[model samples]
Target: MGCDGGTIPKRHELVKGPKKVEKVDKNAELAAKWKYCALSQEKLRRPIVACELGKLYNKDAIIEYLLDKSAERPNTDAVTHIRGTKDIKELNLTDNPEWQGERRSAKGDRYEDIHCGMFICPVVGLEMNGKHRFCYLQTCGCVFSDRALKEVKTEICHKCGDPFQNTDIVVLNGTKEEVEKLREKMEERRRAKAKTKKSKKSKAAESASTPSEAKDDTEVDEVRNGSLENGDESSQSDKAGSSGASRLSSSFNGGVPNLATSKRSIQEMEEKSEAFKSIFTTHSSAKRTKDQTSNWVTHTPYHF
Candidate 1:
C-alpha cells in the first residue's frame, strides 16, 4: 500500500529484516572484570580474595555476603559456590610501583589510563589489567602471569617460594570452560575429604565396639563366678555369724570389704606404734588450740 502523502514504498521498508546483534564494548568488559569485584560489583581494593572458580572479590564484600546471604544483592550467581571463607583464598599480590591510582580529570583535560593496574606479576612484571592472563596458587595465594609461569618452569611459587602443584594453579577471571574444570576439581576434593571422614568414623566405631564386646564377655564371666561363690557361701551361712556377715558385705561391695565399716582406724590399732598413730592429722596431738590456730583469711570474693 502507498502512503497517504503520495510517497513511493521501497521494497526494503515493505518487509522487516533480521535484527542486528548487539555487541558489547571490549574495553568496558575488561574494566568490569579486572577492576571490580565480581560478587559486590564494587571497585577492587586491597585485601582481595578469589574463589575456587577463580573469580576476584573484595574480602569485605565476601564477608558481608556470608553474614547475610538472604539480603538483596546484584550478583548472587558469582558467590553461589562459596559456602564459607574456606572456599576462597586471600591473594598475595605484588604492588605496581608505576601505578598511580585514579586521578580525577577536573576539567576533562587530562587523559585517564584505564590499562593501569594496582597489582603486577612478580615473575615477568606484567600489569594485571585484564590484558594478560593471571593465575593464583591455591596453596600459597601467590599470583603470576601465565606467560611467566610458562617461561619459568618450577614447582615453587615465584614470589613466596612456597611449593605448589600444577593442579593448585587457578586462573583468575577465567573462561567458561576453565571455570567448569575448576568446579569439577573443587567437587572432587570435597568428595575425597568426606570419604576420609566417613572412614575415620567407621574405624572409631569398630575400635569402640571391640572394647565394649570384650568388657561384656568379662562381665558375663564375673557373673558366672559370682553365682558359684554365692551358692558356696549359702551352704556355709549356718556355720558362723561372722562369716555370714562377711559374705553379705562382700556381695554388696562387689566381692570386696566395705573399708568404711569393716576396717579399723590406724589410731585405734593397739599393735601400731604411738609415734605412727600421732603422725595422722586425726590424732589428738595434731589438733590445734585457739591460740595455735592462725587468723582466718578470705582468698576469694565470695563467702559462705
Candidate 2:
C-alpha cells in the first residue's frame, strides 16, 4: 500500500523488529556507584558508611532510613538488610590531595575530571573511582585498594595499624559472588555473638540461683565459733546465762525477742556517771510529774 499523498512506502517501516536492549552509560554507572550513595542516590559526603553487602552509603541517609523504615523512600530495597547502626561501619577514608572538590570550577572554564575520586588509598595511592577494586577492613573501617593489600601482604591495617584477618576485608560495591560470601560471614558472626550472649545470660542466671542464705549462715557460724574460742570459760558461762534468760523471755512473748527487758537502759548503767546519765531523756532526774507537765500542743491559733 502507498501513502495518500503519493509518498513511497519503505519496507523497513512496515515490519517491526525486536526492541534493542538499552545500554546504560559506563561513566554514569561508575559515578553512581563510586561517587553517589547507593541508598539515597545523593553525592557521597563525609562520614560514609558501608553495609555488610559492601554497598556504600552516606551515614546520615542510613540513619534517616533506620529511624523510619516505614517512610516512603525511592531506594528501600538497597537498605532492607540494615536493621540499625551496628549493621554498617563508618569508613575512615583518606582524602585525595589532587582532588579539588566542587570548588575547582565555578566559571566552567576549566575542564572538570568526572572520574576523579574524593578519596585515595593510603598505601598505593589509587583513586577510589570504581576503576579499581577497593575494600574496607571491618575491624578498623579503613579503606584500601585491593592492589595495596595483595602487594603489601600484612595482617595489620595499612591506615589504622589495627590487626585484621582476611575475612574482615569486605569489598566495596562487590560482585554478586563477593556479596554472597560477605552475607554468609555476616550471618556467621551474628550467630556467634548470639551464642555468646546466651551463654553469658545462662552464667548470670546460675550465679543468681546460688543460695545466698547458706553463705550468710556459714558466716554467722564462723563468727560464733571464733568468739567462743577467743573468750575465757567464765565469760562463756555469763553469756550462756544471758542466752537462757533471753530464751525464757522469747517463749513468753511468741518468738519475738523482748529487746526492752533483754538490753539494759543506758541511764541505769552502773559504770555511767550521774552527769552522763542526766543527759539522757529516759533518766529519773529528767522525768516530770503530771502536775508539772503542760499541754503538749506544739502550735495553736488561739492564745491563752
Candidate 3:
C-alpha cells in the first residue's frame, strides 16, 4: 500500500551497472588522419604539404600559421617547430584510378566499393588506407607502401624513376622506431651541409684578407725611392748654405771663407738639430782621428 508520496527510481538510476567502454570509431579516425589537414583539421585538398614527422597538412593552413603564430588554433603543438615555408615540402600525390571523388557515390549506389582509396601506390596495387603501412620519398615526393619497396628492392622510384637512397624514404604515421631512424638521417645530412658552408666561408675570408705578391713588391720599391730622394735634398741644402756664407765673407772683408771651416760649422749645426741627426750620423762620431778643437768654430753668424 502507498502511504507516503515517493518517487519511483528508474532501473538505470537505481541499479549500478558496469561502466560502458568508449567505443572508438576506426573509420572516422582513419579519415581524419588521411583526408584532413593535421594543423587546421580541414579537409585535405590540392597543394598538400607534410612535415618531418610525416603529418599531412594543407599548404594554405601552414602559411596562415606562419603569418600569425599568436592566433589560437586547435593544433598549436603540432606545428610549433615549423618556422617558415622551407620547413615543409609540397607533396606530389598520385590519384587513385578508381577514385570518383563526388561522382562515384553521390547517389549512394549500393554497388560502389566502400574500401576504395583516394590515393594509391603506383608500384603496387595496394591502397593507402590505414589497413596497410605507407611511406613517401622526401627527395621525390613519391608515395608507396613499405611492402612494395621491400618486395621490388630497387633504388629508383617506380613511378618517376628518380634515384633515391634509404634515408630519403619516410614512413607516414610510422612507428616509434621508424620515426627515430628518419630523424637521425635528417640530422646527419644537415650537419654535413653546415660543415661545407662553414668551409666555404673560411676560404672566402682568407682570399679577401691576403694581398697579392705584386702589391708587396711595389710598396717596398716606393720606400727605397723615398729615402734616396731625401738624401739628395739634404746634400744640396748643405752646399747652398756653405756657398752663401763664403760669398758674404768675400764681399765684407775682401777675403773668401775657408771651405773646410764652413763645412765643420754646418756639420755642428746639423748635429744639434734632431732632424739632421736622425737622417745621418754626426761627422765627429764618424771621424777616426782625435777631436780637433782648434779647427772648430764655437760661434757663427748663421744659426742654421
Candidate 4:
C-alpha cells in the first residue's frame, strides 16, 4: 500500500513487498555474476595459438578443452582438424561436420597469465598498480601489453552483444572433477604420443646419417647353438684330427687305415728288435777275432 493515497484513508507502506523486491534484485545480481557472455572461442594449435592468444597456458587449456570435450555446447565453437586419411564422409555418417576453430582474449585466467604474461599480473597487480601484460608461459619471451589482460568475473568484451542463441545456458554441466581427470588423461596420452614420435624420429635420423645404425636387439642371439655332438663341422673335424686323439674314433672301427696302421707299427717294432740283436751278435764276434789276433803265447813262440 502507498503512503500517498487519496482522500478517504491514509495507507501504510508495504514493507513486505519492498523486501521481496530487494531479495529478487539480490538473487538476480548473484545469477548475473556467473553469467558468461559467449563472445568468442577461437582455437589454434599450441605455438600457433600461443602466437595468437598471447601465452602458453591459454594454448594448453584450449587444447585440453577441445580434446577432452569435442562436443561443442550452444555458446561454444569447435575448432578441430583431422590428420587421418579417412575423409569426413567415411569417418562418421551422422557427424560429418568439419569443425571450425574459435579464439578469445578473455585471454585466459591467472593460470594463463602467470605462465604466459608480464612482470606483474592480477595476483601481483593487486599488490601494485600500473602493470604491463607479459608472458609467464615458459615459451612466451616478453611482456606484450597491459590492456589485453582482463578480469574473468566482471568485465566482458561487449563485442558479445549479439545473442546467437542464448536460450540455453549449459548450466556448467558436468563435474569439474571429471574435466580435470580428462585433462590429466589427455596430457598423459599426449606425452606418450610425443615420446613415441620422438623415438621414431631419432631412429630415422640415425638411420639417415649412419647406415649401420644399431638396432635395439643387439644383445640377443640369432639362434641357439646346436648340441655338443652336433656342433660346427669344422670344429668337429679339427677335434678328430688333433694329436693324442682317441684311437676309438668312428673311422677306426672297421677301416683299411686301421689295419694298415697296425701292420706298420708291428713291422717297425720287429725290425728294430732284429737290428739290435744283430748288432750285439756282430760286436761279440768282432771282439773274439781281435782276441785271437792279439794272443800273447803266439807272439812269444820259443819261450814255452
Candidate 5:
C-alpha cells in the first residue's frame, strides 16, 4: 500500500524467521546472497548490500528509469517482505517527492548508490574532494565512519529525504524561529549604527561652533573696552578746552592782547577730537600690535 487517505493503523505482521524481500536485480540477489537482512538469517553479521542505483544514475533519462525501477521496487518488497527505503530520497521534498511512489523516508536507501550506474559502491565513506561532505544515508546508517557527524553535516542521506544534519539528526529542517532571530539581529545592528551616527554628528557640530563663539565673545569685549576708553579721553579733552578758553578770556580782560584766535583754536580742537574719535576703533589686538611694531617709525610724528 498506499497511506493516502487516512491513518490505517496498519500493522506489520511480526515474523519469527528471516523473510526474503526480492528486489528486481538478479545480480543483487547473486551478490548479496551471502549476506542477509538483520531480521533475516543473519542479524549479527556485517550488513551486506548491493548498491545498484549508483550504476544507473548516469543515464540522461534517469526519471523514466526510476519509474520503471519503482515498478520493480514494489515487487521487490512483496517478494522480500522488507520495509521501503529509509530517509534518503534525492529530489527536493516539496517537488518530485516520489519517484514511482517511493519516499525518501523509506526504511532503506536502496536507490542512492547510483552514480551513472557505476560499479558497485563501497560500503565505507564517500566524501567530496574538499572534505566537506560524506555519505551516511540509508545505504550506510551512520556506521563505522571517521567523524560520522562531520560527514552528515556535509553529506546527503537517503533516510530523511534531506541533506544530513550531521550524523545525529538527518532532517534538521530549516525552522521559522531561526530565520526570525537572524532578522532581529540585523535590525538591532542597524539601530545601533544609527544611534552612533547621530551622536557623532552632534559632537561634530558642537566642536565646530566652539571656536567661532569664543572669537565673537572676544570681539564684543574689545569693542566695549574701546567705547569706555573713548568716553574717558573725550571728557578729559573737553575739560582742558574749557580751561584754555577761560584763561584766554581772563588774560584778554586783564590787558593781554585781544586774542580773537582763541575761539578758532577751540574749533580746531573740536575737529581734531572728532578725527581722533575714529582712531579709537576696536581693531583686532593682534593686527593692531603687528602694525604698530612694524611701523614704529611711521608713528613717531603722531605719537610725539
Candidate 6:
C-alpha cells in the first residue's frame, strides 16, 4: 500500500520507534518543595512566612501582593485566602552552618553534597533535606526534625521555650494523612472562635437594649428630683420675703415688732376680712362683685 509515485518514500523511512520515557529527578523535586517558596517559585529567603494551610512563602512577596491586590500575578490562586499580614506567621528559621549557599555550587568539585540542607534542627542536629520528616511549631514557627520532638517530648518549644500542643506542630511537606489531620484541626479552631465571638456579640446586644422597667425607674427618679428642687426654691423665696417685710416694718415704725407679735397681727387682720377663709385655702384680697356675692349667697352660707 506504499505510494507508487516517483517521489514516494519506502515503509522503513516513514516508520517511527517507540517514544522514550522522561526521567524525573527526585533530588530536584525534593529541593523545590523544601528550598523554594510555594507562591513565587523562587528560592526561600529570610523572613519566610507560612499560611494556615502550611504552605511556605517569602515574606516580601506576600507583602507586595497585599499592598497591590489588583496587580496581575501568575500564582494568584496560591495565596487567595491570605487577606492580611495576620494570615501568615513569619518563620524563625535557623541558619545551617554547613550550607555554603550559591558559592558551594561555584566550586565545581568532583563530588557535590546534593543532600546538603539550608537548615538543621537545633536540638538533634538533623539535616532538613527531605530525607527525614520535619515539623514546625505554629506558636513560634520554629522548625525541628520530627525525631527530635518525639524523643524529647516536652510541652515547651525546644528552640524558643514557647508552650505548644500536639495540634500546633504542623508537619512540613507531610503525607496526605498528616495534611488532612491538620485541616480538621484548623476548621475546629475556627469554628470555636466564631462561636465565642457570636456569644459575646449577643451579650453586648442584650446589655444595650435595657428593659422598660429600668426606663420607668429612671423617669420616677427624675420626677422626684424635680419636686425636691421646687420645694427648696419655695422655702428659699419665703425666707427672703419674711426678711424684707421685717426690714420695711422697722424702717416705718421706728423699730421692728417682736417676731411672734407680728405673726399674730397678720393672722388677726386676715381673719377680719370678708374674703378670709382657711389659711391653706384660696381667699379674695379685694371685695367681691354683686354677681359673685349673689351666686355665693345662693350656693351656701358665706363664711369668711
Q: What is the lDDT of residue 150 in candidate 5?
A: 42
Deviation in Å, model 1, residue 174 alpha carbon: 1.0
Looking at model 6, residue 255 earns an lDDT score of 59
Candidate 1 yields a Cα-based lDDT of 0.88
Q: Write the number of the candidate with greater lDDT, choosing between 4 and 6.
A: 6
- What TM-score number comes out for model 5? 0.25
What number of clashing residue pairs does each candidate have, in the order they appear?
0, 0, 0, 19, 28, 0
lDDT, candidate 3, at 42: 91
Q: How does each model score on lDDT? A: 0.88, 0.87, 0.78, 0.33, 0.39, 0.81
Q: Which 10 successive residues of model 5 have the least lDDT summed?
A: 50-59
Candidate 3 deviant stretches above 4 angstroms: 1-23, 104-114, 212-304
lDDT of each residue in 49-134, candidate 2, tens digit only:
99989999999999999888889887899888888999999999999999988778668788778899999999999999999999
- Weakest lDDT window of 10 consecutive positions for candidate 1: 295-304
Off by over 4 Å in 5: 1-192, 246-254, 258-304
- lDDT per residue as tens, model 6, 115-146: 89998999999898999988888898998899
lDDT of 5 by residue, 176-259 (tens): 564355345435755898899999999999999998999999999999999999999999999999999998787677444454
Looking at candidate 2, what is the lDDT of residue 107?
Answer: 82
For 34-140, candidate 4 gives per-residue lDDT tens digits of 12211123322223222111112234444454455655444333223212211011100011122211333454563322122112332323211122223222122
Across 40-63, the per-residue lDDT of candidate 3 in tens digits comes to 999888898887778889999999
Better of 1 and 3 by lDDT: 1
Error of 2 at 138 (Å): 1.3
Task: Assess candidate 4 and give its TM-score to the true structure.
Answer: 0.22
